[model samples]
Target: MALASIPTKQYIEQREEGYWIKGSRVSLDSVVYSFLEGETPEVIAQNFPLLSLEQVYGAITFYLANREFVNTYLQNGEAEFGQLQKDCQQRSPQLYQLLMAGQARLSQAS
Candidate 1:
């Protein structure tokens, strides 16, 4: 089947990554990114309570169908995250301190 033949309502285009998938209302990129970050499907589902197992699978299908685009997105995200970390360290020392403190707390909790 053609790409256009895919049902629109069943999917949504991720704004940051610009990819489409079923369940337009859901943030598939966020889900996929969480998975890439070593999060389990159950954890992801907990984060997105409205998402079903089938919908999560559909997001994976969408990612597989557009591997290059998703890979680029992941690459760009790392670059952007690095830039943001640098900027935050330079431009917002107090915020950086607060973030570090939060991270420390999280680590201790874990």
Candidate 2:
């Protein structure tokens, strides 16, 4: 049997910042992370609720064409998130402990 080809979608115009993800009103960096997490264009569109399917596909295409840039963005986002988590933990020990325990359980299960 022959494999089916995915349909090509039109590119969405980006905002003046040039870092806008086609599908989401959010920054390109955010969309890159979402895509890296294995989210589908449809899922991204649903999450944003403001972007069209064409925009989502366009964002994916843009990311694919600029893998290096997007990878850097993802790395920076991870670092930022880690810092935020550390700050939260420092500010709230009890909450941090609870969250840490939950994460430990989740890691063990996985």
State the local distance difference test value for candidate 2.
Answer: 0.76
lDDT of 1 by residue, 1-110 (tens): 55565554344465655554444566666878877888877777787888876667667777778789778877887899999999999999999999999999999999
What is the clash count of model 2?
Answer: 0
| Clash count in backbone of candidate 1 | 6
lDDT for 45 (candidate 2)? 82
Error of 2 at 3 (Å): 35
lDDT of each: 0.74, 0.76
Off by over 4 Å in 2: 1-19, 22-24, 27-30, 37-39, 99-110
Extract clashing residue pairs from model 1.
Answer: 10-22, 10-23, 11-21, 11-22, 11-23, 12-24
* Best by the TM-score measure: 1
Global fold similarity of model 2 (TM-score): 0.59
